[model samples]
Target: MADHCNGSSHSSESFANIPPIKFTKLFINGNFVDSVSGKTFEAIDPRTGEAITLVSKGDKEDVDLAVKAARFAFDNGPWPRLSGSERGRILMKLADLIEENIEEIASLDAINGGKLFSLCKLIDIPAASMALRYYAGAADKIHGTVLKLSKGLQGYTLREPIGVVGAIIPWNFPTIMFFMKVAPALAAGCTIVVKPAEQTPLSALYYAHLAKLAGVPDGVLNVVNGYGETAGAAISSHMDIDKVSFTGSTEVGRKIMVAAATSNLKPVSLELGGKSPLLIFDDADVDEAANIAFNGMFFNKGEICVASSRVYVQEGIYDKIVDKLVEKAKALVVGDPFDPQVNQGPQTDKKQFEKILSYIEHGKREGATLLTGGKHIGQKGYYIQPTIFADVKNYGRGD
Candidate 1:
């Protein structure tokens, strides 16, 4: 791997301005309140495996209160009663507010989620702002269908907001996931209760403050920070919730599906975890192909849901591509995300870090040839090498 260099290459701004933790309690009914049980959980920084702050641990009672607030907002508040153009204006203002504090928000995710600081600042924050603006533009354009019957009868359908939404976002991409789920629901005039992942709850809480500043009505947007078993379970099975949106493991998605079905039959939108495949033909340039495959596999420490983890190459150029890939993998710098020279940072949290190591061990025990990397790298944080295996009997699974 390349040697660590100075931090002044890309970002001219100083990392000295990393903001202090301002909000940690559950945001409900346009107020920051403690959980009903007065329980709190640690928000650990994956960079050092240390507690950054103690966040309120919300349970069923907290979820119920948030739901009650959301129901009241949706049923009687001016948020749902407002015109689409008015809603669109408010969302646009929210987007602007996000851009204003983009750097502070980006730093929060980098510390809380172990993501590369430059990536968070340059890509994720901008994408989040654009997502809000994108959905805001659609607010006024939501429409229903008007049909003419065979007998010249007029028929029309109305497009109404789906009531309260429960958003459970994963830790990998906190800011993007928050905006992706939230902007649309707000555009549709729906009240929502958000349950951010425990590992990366800071950014979500900061956003709740910004949403209020941008004129989002109280109870229209509520954020409950806690574990999935308590808060997320309540959201999925709650009777007042109209729908549940989750982005995480497939295992949890299945459970959420069952819970939604057994309850009031509320709908759900799930973005489950899985990997994809990458192919290289003989006609392609071998070096370029290797570079592409390296990025596809190792981006975001290979934590992406649809990452290109499997590779199928044409035999004519297979050997050359493998050699190039091994070379590139070794040269990848794994270190602190704040260091601009580092190509990859630590994993999101300890559970994911050890989980990856176990998978590597499984591949070794199963007799897959270890091609390049398959070991831990750093001492203080959760850092794993960019692992690659070859000649697998299956997709790295043989029993």
Candidate 2:
């Protein structure tokens, strides 16, 4: 199916004019409230390595409240009793609402998560809205399977919504992850408590507000924003939750698996980090292939879990492709995300920035040839020069 998202058209007036942070409180029971401890954490702007706004910091106590709300909604609320078409209508309204406020929502992620403004507005946020609509259309189509039996004992299997769901999403693609996890659950009539990554919580909170405005019942969707060890760990182990869906690092995925098992043996869905690779043969178009390689390895500053970090080329085109990649890297623009000419934004945060630099140093020491740019671009933000390595040893991870 073709994507119906808005086209990429941004203005200097709008990109440069970012509005102030709108939603920062924990969303529960259809209301935005402060954390139990009244603690707040700074949501940083990677553009200048500074704090953009302070968001309510949720911990175990807050997570418990959010879970309770979701459980009650599942067990006693009107959402589960509503007709599937009614639920679908509400979800469709939510998607339309997201489009109505796309500018503000897109700007929030770009400012807080260090993603390119044009890309967020044009591609990511709009795609999220479309995803919601797609699931909305499927809401009414869920059904049970007919079965055959012998001896006049005929019956059919019934399908039902899973209970309360705990959704944990990474910061790399906040908008997409939010819908990818939450939409299907909502379509099936399951309430959810989401724990968005601390680095980028503003947009999730905004979406929560929009969901409520679109007539989704209170407690059907809740968002808790905080550090992973506290709020996230609580969600992973919460006994009342019927299922858990997580996306992030592999190490954390292990912890969630353990917690889900010991607490209640609840099933889990995890999307963990991995090194996906791309191989280019000699017959492919060198220029187009190089562009694909660059994008696969470096889109969103190479922050995606499926980023094609490892690339292999046939010996015949190896040198030629490397030359083309080098030229593209040199001409690439790196600066404020709002800049139309900027091809890449800063690392999501200082920790990510420093980690990439350390990895570059390690690669150099380990005998990988530094093929192109490998230096920090600016002193203000968490920026790094786009880098590539040649003559790399076939070193698997953790070797």
Candidate 3:
């Protein structure tokens, strides 16, 4: 692995403004350290096809360490023993820290995840803080229900923190997913062993630092960064993890379920992939529908799982909707995410870039007419123009 570098070689005016980054180690037991195996992996910058930094390459061994720490925290630490109001206060402090460091967090997300800097600054970072704060409020309110049993016998059930949680988040929305998983776990008073997707580990590590600063106790939260097969599988199958939460592809979700089932019969929650469709009726306003569809399908460079890639329109309004959508597609700016003028950025990595291009090729081969974009943007970077295919037919064989 290359030595830690600040990504200073990229000369884009926007890139220059980004804060320097140096923390690339795995966060475990409230400290950043190299992997036990002393291995590191290169984090690629999709915008420039250059190395951003070398992050610790965590595997099953690292997962075990993180999970053990979480288990210890849950079983013996003050975090779980603390009152809900105290926990809430701590989480609220974490939210404040997130807001205080929003710029650096948003910039890390933008540069590392190939996300729009403006969007990260304006939407993702704030949303993360909001999630933490909302969960913080909920922390004090975790309760139970009283039931009137049969024969006039009264009974009540109490809600308690389910031990350690293993959170496996995806690469598409790093900042949001981190809070979506971590905040709730923290609110519920469950210690966590987080396995951030390898592709976007910077913001998560930075978040861990901020979490420590906000007074999250050591061993209450741990982050192990690695590929899915190793760290993720370890978390899913670990006997100590009480719950496994995953957000990613269906294929991986299935594997997680099996691992959970086969190992300890642990409960699992999955937010897997979905096929989103946009339907427009003749009575709907054409321009309004066009803008919504464009935003729905093309936002985040079409990397969203719920991206509205499929469109169905009433016959009477088909031509008008397509014309407006096509015009909107053509107008989308594709370039560096940091550039305020550019609305689109490169694909998150080379694999996703090639995968999207392959799908575009398949769309053409399957007889869909390419209306606006059909090729890549520039010589460097994994960038494809905002592609639009019309006159499409669903010709594929189905299961």
Residue pairs with backbone atoms closer than 3 Å in model 1 (clashes): none
- For every model shown, what is its TM-score relative to the native structure? 0.94, 0.95, 0.95
**Candidate order by decreasing lDDT:** 2, 1, 3
Candidate 3: segments with Cα more than 4 A from true spot = 1-16, 150-152, 396-399
Off by over 4 Å in 1: 1-16, 395-399
Given candidate 3, what's the lDDT at residue 99?
Answer: 88
TM-score of 3: 0.95
216: Cα error in model 2, Å:
0.6
lDDT winner: 2
Per residue, candidate 1 scores C-alpha lDDT tens digits across 1-399 of 222212111222223356899999999999999999999999887777888899999999999999999999999999988989999999999999999998789889888888888899789999999999999999999999999987869899999999999999999999999999999999999999999998899999999999999999999999999999989999999999999999999999999999999999999999999868898999998878888898889888888998888888888998888888777887787777777778887799999999999989999998988987787764566777777888765545563
lDDT of each: 0.88, 0.89, 0.87
Error of 3 at 58 (Å): 0.5
